[model samples]
Target: MGYTIKDTRHLKNILRADFILGGLTAFTGLVFFRPLEGFLGLSQPFIILVPLANILYATAAFTLATAQRNPSIPLLRLLIGANWFWTLLSVALLYVHYTNVTTFGLTTLLFQIVIVGTLAYLEGNQLEKMA
Candidate 1:
């Protein structure tokens, strides 16, 4: 199947949204890690590393979103894979810390899982259409 221009636009939008959300997550984690550590009851390394990882992911997302032509299928596949990985990782973290995580922390993890998973699904669906 061939993709239309509209499909390209939709893919770009999804990538852009992922970039924006990831940037926000990174910024919030970096700026408020001290408080987040206490509130989330997670390790300091986890708090700091997540934001760093997000920074890289966001940069990749933005680059792909702004490509002059349609982004490559392989790259999009990798992005979708990363989104799924992050979603699953969040779920694992939630499970690991369920006993100690604050209500707010649990909520935060749930939101991350849902949002990232949704993005992964959207990206994957778009890719399937292109394929």
Candidate 2:
């Protein structure tokens, strides 16, 4: 089955929303990483990975929001790629316990994966529909 023009357009709008949501998720991850670790006893990776991911996400959020306002396919494609990579890495690392991560850490990681995976799913669907 094919998507109608309206459906495609709606999906594009949804992609923008998804991007905005992803940005929020990233920002949340950035801010909460430390607090969650110190107070909540959730062990996360070291400085580089945590901050870097959030920074990237924040940057992507701005880029995607701009793309949505500007209606740029290239920008959308870039965001789609970023989301795929981010989600894949997140899922891969979500369960790896070679290091010492607490139960809270594991549960939080799973929760984060769900949120990120949803965003990825939205982005993928939007991209496919746009095609």
Candidate 3:
């Protein structure tokens, strides 16, 4: 098909990383309900948003991985932009205290933001290399 695996290795690897991270996030989100609600004392809506965010992350990861299979720069760029947007939203969430939260919840949220931001940064570098 005139395509070499080496040609897309960088993007493929980045996408794979995001995919794995998303999977882990979603899995953790499953148990997050109790801790987020009980320990953090989060409200119904915000707590529900946690799992929804995980779903979005999973969806984005799947789309990115699919895009990597064909290696479309524009599509990858759009997805990367969305990931950065998510990171920013996560940052905003840090300041907005719609409900109470424990140290664990706050720390977990911050760490997740850092993880996603780092992934986006790496992906950006890979995209630059692709160019």
Candidate 4:
């Protein structure tokens, strides 16, 4: 049986919401990474590396947001993987801090969960469309 692609016109709100959420995710990631040395007591090497990861995440969010509006390539697939990887890493860190979880850390962890969940849902819908 053949499948049909739904019109994106009806998804205007979703599209818009994704764009906004993606931007927020990117911005928050950048903000949270800035004071990593103070917040996480990271060494120089870790401070450098974590910021790089944040940069990559921000870039991926921007790419995903763009792809959501204009489906030209398989960028969303890359985004899905990147987002999942980052989310997993962040969750791991949160788990590490579970013994002495700070308010800031807990709040950031919750935000990451929300953003990852949203990205997962959007990516799944996009993949279904492709199939």
Which candidate comes out best when scored by lDDT?
1
* Candidate 4 accuracy as lDDT: 0.56
**What is candidate 1's lDDT per residue for 9-101, written digit by digit as tens?**
888999999999999999999999999998988777998999999998898889889999988776777888999999999999999999988
**Which model, 1 or 3, shows the larger TM-score?**
1
Lowest summed lDDT window (length 10), candidate 2? 1-10
Question: Candidate 1: TM-score?
Answer: 0.90
Residue 54 lDDT in candidate 2: 55
Q: TM-score each candidate.
A: 0.90, 0.62, 0.74, 0.59
For model 2, residues 1-131, the per-residue Cα lDDT tens digits are 33222345565566556656656656666677767665434455652365566566556555655553434556556666776676677677765652456666667567666766676676556543434
lDDT tens per residue, model 3, 1-131: 12223336666777778877777766765666666576665565776776677677667666767772566666667667877888888778877853456786677668868988988787776643322
How far in Å is the alpha carbon of 73 misplaced in model 4? 4.3
Q: Which residue pairs in candidate 3 collide? A: none
lDDT of 4 at 77: 57
Error of 3 at 3 (Å): 18
* Residue 12 miss distance in model 2 (angstroms): 5.3
Error of 1 at 55 (Å): 1.0
Comparing candidate 3 with candidate 4, which one achieves the higher lDDT? Answer: 3
TM-score of 4: 0.59
